[model samples]
Target: MSPKASTRVARGIITFLFIYLATPIVVTMIYSFSTSWVKTILPNGLTLKWYSELVASPEFMAVLLRSFSLGLLTTLIAMACFLPVVFYANVYNPQVKSHLRFITVLPFTIPGIILVTGLIQLYAELPIPKIIILVLAISLLSLPLTYQALDNAFIGRDFRAMFEQALVLGDSPFKAFVKVIIPNIRAGVLVAMLLTFTSAFGEYVLTNLLLGGNFETLKIYMYRLMRSNGQASSVLTTIYFIFLAFISLILILIMQHYSAPHKSTKEGAKK
Candidate 1:
């Protein structure tokens, strides 16, 4: 194909895909604002009552708080468990990364239902809090994303030399890593944390099964609303979609902010 024709074809395909994926989200957003949408091609009337009711409820606030806590704790635990391991695997023993690949497919292979069943069998009678087990399990599930992001941060950079130089300059190993290595990988860490947090926030199966609905997070609440009130459920779903879009916007901004410096340097070198 000619260059112009190929460009037009690519743009056409992209536009079609964008609309295809966005249609359901658009309909849901509209439904959330509609007074009624039954057996009709379009909504009966538009109103904000659903959103107002959802936002005004104390239960909604509690659900948000619980989900936020889950997301934050899961992110922290995932980072604590994986950061050092990924750094060591990447900077010192590259061979270990081969074994670590198993983690990437862990969720697929084991599945949440099986994992939860095992947890129930193992820790059902234990004195340990199920909340602790829930947090740890969610963290473990998020590890593959955290590991890959941290490992990629080590690429094209001599982190070992940086660490050694910092150590030689009278910094302790932990201090050296915090000061020298972390700043360089801050963007990747942020990306990993965001991904981990999002995964843990929307988690349904494990949270519902493990906590037995005593700890109702956002997803569980949404499910409850879905069975009783469709309008409220739509509103919650829209809010969740907005939250994910906000996260994606942050990721894009972080990528652009980091890439701009490299682009400028490349142009300067060429000049």
Candidate 2:
């Protein structure tokens, strides 16, 4: 094929893929407000009744809150655990970075179904809280992406210059990290936070398997009830998507803001 034709074909394929990916989202959103609930064609009209019913359901409401709390906790813990490792890998030891990266990505390469099954058997033998176990399981899935994002953001950065800049201005290493490196990669941090939280929040398989019917995240709740109440399930899914999308948008906005030239201001203070 001619280069021009190939380019056109590629664009067409890209468009097709986007639409294909988006089809389910659009349909679900439509069904969230769908009234007729049943038909060969589209719903007769949209309504808010499904959402009202969803909000009134106590079990799902609690699940939604639990999911949020779990996601937030996971994001915080993952950042605490991974951030320093990323800095050390990038600044002090680039040679071992490859191994660290592999460790993060390994979980993803393993089939989740198999992993969850293994976790289920393992958790059954432990004395930990099921919710905590489930949260950790989901966080493992998100850790690699978070590590990569922060690592990528700092790839071309000069840590020595950053440290010097902070020190001259009266900053300790801890202060420098908090004030300099963290601020510089605020975008990446925000991206990582949102991505990690979303991954943990929406995770269903691990939560279901590890929690073992003892608890439910929002996704688990949605899955359990979707069969008996399609419209209500659709509404819950829509609300979840909306909330996730909003968080994602805020992350995108943070990235845009930090993309400009910004200096590190957190140095040389009271340790």
Best candidate (score: lDDT): 1
Q: What are the clashing pairs of model 2?
A: 170-268, 171-267, 171-268
lDDT of 1 at 235: 99
> In candidate 1, how many clashes are counted?
0
Error of 1 at 237 (Å): 0.6
Query: Deviation in angstroms for 129 in model 2?
Result: 2.7
The sequence of per-residue lDDT tens digits that candidate 1 reaches over residues 14-94 is 999999999989999999999999999999999999999999999999999999999999999999989999899888998
Candidate 2 lDDT tens digits, 140-256? 788788988878878677986887789899888899988788876776777888889888888777777666477778888888778888888888878888898898788777766
Displacement of residue 106 (Cα, Å) in model 2 is: 0.8
Question: What TM-score fits each model?
Answer: 0.91, 0.84
Candidate 2: regions farther than 4 A off: 1-15, 113-126, 164-170, 261-271
lDDT comparing candidate 1 with the true structure: 0.91
Q: State residue 152's C-alpha deviation in candidate 2, in Å.
A: 1.2
Poorest stretch of ten by lDDT in candidate 2: 262-271
lDDT of model 1 at residue 65?
Answer: 97
